[model samples]
Target: MTPQEALFKYTLRLGDNALIQGHRLSEWCSKGPILEEDLALTNIALDNIGLAQAFLKYAADIEGKGKTEDDLAYKRPERQFYNHQITELPIGDFAVTIAKQLLISAFEVPLFSALSHSTDETIAGIAAKGVKESRYHFVHSRDWCYRLGEGTELSHSKLQQAIHDLWAYTGELFEMAEEDTILLVAGIAVDLEELRPLWKETVATVLTEATIQIPEDGTMHTGSRNGVHTEHLGHILAEMQYLQRAYPDATW
Candidate 1:
């Protein structure tokens, strides 16, 4: 693929991850454990959505297809989406949500930090802005991991199980594709393989502090990069695209 094509696909991958994960977190809008926590999750959701808009707008511009960010987000079929499978999974319980957030945020923190220096100006700018937000996301999720993991017997057990269930999906976060390799050689994308060791260190430190054992690595679930996803993504698209699909061009 051409560098432009690689960059466009890379941008879409970044935006889709934020868009889908934001929607999942928005599911907790009024369902957080407490009012403050509820607002926190909602605010984080907004952050992700805002990030999505930035990346997708740039992607649309790169594609020269005249598609707006909304079109790319709400009009795409499920197979066209490129978000990580972990991002689209059902939120499950509170512990599960935190587990997902912890895993994703940890990756983004370092990923964006490196991307801030990307040879592509737009990507660098977006990463610079995103680094701060992702850091907060990492901290928030990490704190909660500790809170639940060390709190009570039930809380500890649930958090541990959440970690166990989510571990299989973490490997995909570091899985590189040809598009990624292209950008990597051009200095326009992160080397996810490099980020993996740092991500593991950050997560392992937190898990140790929480007195939680890291699950043994098993077969890693993947395919999101190639547009294959868990069954959950279809449901996400059905709901997220409903308004646009049902009433094209209708506006407030």
Candidate 2:
């Protein structure tokens, strides 16, 4: 793929990941375990969606296509979305939800940090702005990971389960896909295979600090970069695509 194409694909994945996760996070709008947590999750959800919109806009521009962000977001089928399986998983309990958020944002920080220096002007610009937001999201999610993992015995156990249950899906986070190859060749993306050790180190340290045990020997599940998504994405799309589906030309 050409540099332009590679950059476009990379950015869209970034956008789709953020958007779908934001949508899932929104489910906590009124149902959080506490008022502060409800507000915090809501804030993070809004931030993620805002970042997605910025990324989607830039991605569409790079594609040189007239498709709007909504078209890519609402009109695309499940298999076309490039988000990892973990992002599409149900929020489950508050602890699990926060745990996944921490994991994703942790991965995102380094990815965006690296992207901030891309040769592609548009991609770099987006990443420069995005890295800051990602940093904030990382901090927020990590704090909760620590709180839940280090708190009462029940919180610690639940947090540990959340980490292990989600660990298999994490293999998808560091594997380079066609998209990664394309972008890395173009000087517009990180070499994800190289990010694995850092990812493991940072995640393990955070888990250690939280008093959560890292999963050592679980089978590593994969297949997100190729657009193979989990079952939850279908359900997520059912809700996300509803307005556009119900009224093809509907506008807000």
Candidate 3:
């Protein structure tokens, strides 16, 4: 692919990750364990969605398309979305959600930190903003991992199971595509492989503090980078795109 195509896909990938993960977090809106936690998750959701808008708008500009961020987000089919599979997984339980967030936030902290210095001005600007938000998210998830993993026996058990179940999906986060390689050479994208060691170290440190045993790495799940995802993304789009699909061009 050309540099322009790679840049567009790279931007869209970032936007999709933020948008899908934000939608998952928003599901906890009123369902959080307490009022403060409820507000916290929703606020994070808003932050991610806002970030998604920035990335998607940049992607649209890069594509030289008239599409708005809303059009790209609401009109894309499941196979067209490039979000990591982990982000699209259902928010199963409180412990599971925390586990997912812990892994994702840890990855984002370093990934965005590097991207903040990208040669691409727009990507660097977005990453500069993203680094701050992602750091907060990482801290929040890390603290909760400590709490849930060391609390009651039941809580500890749930946290352990969640980690075990989610471990395989973590590998997919670092899976690079041809677009990523192009952008890497152009200094427009982080080398995800470089982020893996840092991500593992951060995760291992947090898990140790949480008194949770790190699961052994096994066969890894992947394919989202290639526009393939688990069944969960279909459900996400069905709900997210309902209004846009039903109303056609209706706008308030």
Specify the highest-lDDT model's number: 1
Per-residue CA lDDT of candidate 1, range 74-185, in tens?
A: 8989988999999999999999999999999999999999999999999999999999999999999999998998999999999999999999999999989989999999
- lDDT for 93 in candidate 3 is 91
By the TM-score metric, which is better: model 2 or model 3?
A: 3
Worst 10 residues of 1 by lDDT: 243-252
Tens digits of per-residue lDDT, candidate 3, 52-90, equal 999999999998879899999999898889999999999
Give the alpha-carbon lDDT of every model: 0.94, 0.85, 0.93
Ranking by lDDT: 1, 3, 2
Q: Could you estimate the TM-score for every candidate?
A: 0.99, 0.94, 0.99
Off by over 4 Å in 2: 1-4
TM-score of 2: 0.94
Query: In model 3, where do residues sit more than 4 Å from their true spots?
Result: none
